[model samples]
Target: MSTLTAVNPLTTLERRALQSISTSDGNMLIVAADQRNSMKAVIKDAPNGSDAITREELIEVKADLVRHLANHGPAILLDPEVAVPYVVDEGVIARDTALVVGLDASGAETVDGLKYTRFVPGVTPRTVRDLGGGVAKMLYYTRPDRQGTDSRIFAEMRDLIAECNAEGVLLIVELLTYQLEGESDEDYAAAFAGLVADGAALAVRAGAKILKLQYPGSAEASAAVTEAAQGVPWAVLSAGVDHETFIGQVATAVANGASGAMAGRSLWKDSLSYDATLREELLTGRALPRLRELADAVDGRRG
Candidate 1:
């Protein structure tokens, strides 16, 4: 498809109407698009009836996927910069224009640990750069506990962000807290908020603008979001599970003073039927009504 068609999508834009929502500084609502974060996919022989996928073919798939997502309406595009450029180099699919979001996180570490040098080897040195002169941002995901700050990992993040500089790259962060699967929603939200605040503070001091952190669950979630975002220019809340859940969550985030949101599975998990309907709503300005309703529901309910 032509770049014009991909971006303008003459048909309609209910999904693209995202900017009309709420914003801070320059709020951005994005959708995370990645089937796998495996830096290098371990190729394997496929069973009969399966088509072989060459590295070039995989690059094409990645590019096309990006194009498809770009049409969905996102001010910021989240993905590992290193992997994205690989596809661009192949010319299979070149979404040369996008706001880059870089995330560096690990499994068993604390907030401070991420600030140091110890990190999952594969996710080190999170960096962001300009793609087609648009905007670029980077964020280092880390745990909050001082013990969690691994020397190697944090050092990598510190160096990478500092080197990226301004004019081309914007770096911020998101911190995950609690065992996502085991903690209570409230506790989980508290942990997430505390960690987000810690990371947000660090990122801003170094020139980062947005903090893409966990979704605070309820009022506490709102408070955490508010607290973490204190003095920060902007923030993007993590995506939730479904449209309803995401809307509610986003509403809370906005109330907590978030500028926009970054959603993934929650936005694309629906059938094509839903996409068409949602798209139309955005183009016609009809979704604003619904957004208001959502905002009402989300108030004081961030967890």
Candidate 2:
């Protein structure tokens, strides 16, 4: 647990929602299946997969993940387009697992080399609550190194936060930084940590109570993010790194004051397949073990 004090008190419902999605010890281990375009790319690249990925196929993949992994975590993050409602209605998710619905659209629009976030139409905090989701997640792309780049998005986020507060839904604001066109990879890597910390600070200033952020380069940077959060309970996102790498990142982040982890591809990417039997085997043998390792990392039980 972080020693930093919370700046704002959580509302009754917000506190309940947070508790519902977290372990008894107050750490969160959230499995993320909210991906859309990236998931389609995976499906398309599968050995037996066709060029055209169907909605049913996507739902099946998500269902398999939920059936196999939901029981191992306190919450699962799903998107409104495919996973939401379907997973809940089918009862594939574990009864004890809480649902978090992603409000962002499938992909972002790149304008002048910067990515802009878009929300799924009609997917708001109230609608998420109506859909039986205990929390709402909104992913926003930011360029903290570039001044004034995220002013509009921050304004929109403030409105969303107010709406969530009014509806009594806890919102987890997820921040992702992107490299601009023509920027050198080395420069981007060097600035990555500060960008994440600055982005977290910006979100906190915009009234974010909870956050999901990318790995901030190193342990010291992770501590910087914790400081920027001001006790808002930030979690580290996997960013599609390999499972082993993600585990190390999670371990470092948690040790440096991250609340826990929110991961998707790092846990289940290789387990995806068209063959049901093979998929099950891979999920059980590969993904489940990875999930356990991640959970252990979150709880500080890993050797």
Candidate 3:
């Protein structure tokens, strides 16, 4: 939806936003507690009487989440600007981490006055630079090619990403890579490559700042190390029902090219009946002793 004639790299604020991403400092994890996963944390006290969490309860939990994350040092991403206050009510998110939109990175409509946003439509780097678009970011989507088109959807997205670059917007491509299982590991890896190649092409042609690449489904073996953060920042699942299932996903993210992960359900769901501190521990990977150990090590480095 951009109307720029020439393309360019992201602007200053855009770059700052992109560089602000961290999986641990509490800036980019999906933390809203009203949805299905309740961001993995149960909502024992929703004042609104609806599934959507209330500000008061969020205020209480957010502080605890931040403290837990500070000790662990990771950023979490939540949706709806209304929740922005929870992250920065006291200027915490503004001071400690980066936040990305946690909306439906797959749609552009609204429900119950809630805009189910997937991408930031009608915006570009020029808009951010010339217009009042400000330091806005975008979320890209992936999955089985919809609308009967080919995987060329990536290329089409590449062009749009170019426009977003010129408009000073950050385009983060989400990873709905494959149908999980029934495919070979090599095929899955190639799919990830294809996704990255699309992002790299867009960056080279124009200059988008971030690549929200998700990992391959068939092989959840790459996301936990330097390999995961290879091309750009990527998002990983909060967790799967199984233990090895989630760890494998994190491992793949690290192996491919991901600096951090944004997780929800796995952390919160299991903590439904637990106390806030214990819930915090679970979300920070304490439930899984190995994960908690890893978090402590990461925190040690930052300290």
Best candidate (score: lDDT): 2
Clashing pairs in 2: none
lDDT by residue (tens digit), candidate 1, 142-200: 55444233444355555655544423344444544444445588775556656666655
lDDT of 2 at 217: 79
Worst 10 residues of 2 by lDDT: 42-51
User: Mind giving the per-residue lDDT tens digits that candidate 3 earns over 61-128?
Assistant: 65555455432433444444334445554655535444444433334443332222343343344534
lDDT per residue for candidate 2 within 149-266, as digits (tens), equals: 2577678778899999998889999999988899999999888899999999888888999999999978999999999888899999999999999999989988888998998999
**Which prediction has the highest TM-score against the true structure?**
2
As a whole number from 0 to 100, the lDDT of residue 247 in candidate 2 is 91
Q: In model 2, how many backbone clashes occur?
A: 0
- Residue ranges of candidate 1 with Cα displaced over 4 Å: 1-25, 34-58, 72-83, 86-97, 101-139, 147-157, 178-190, 205-207, 237-240, 269-303
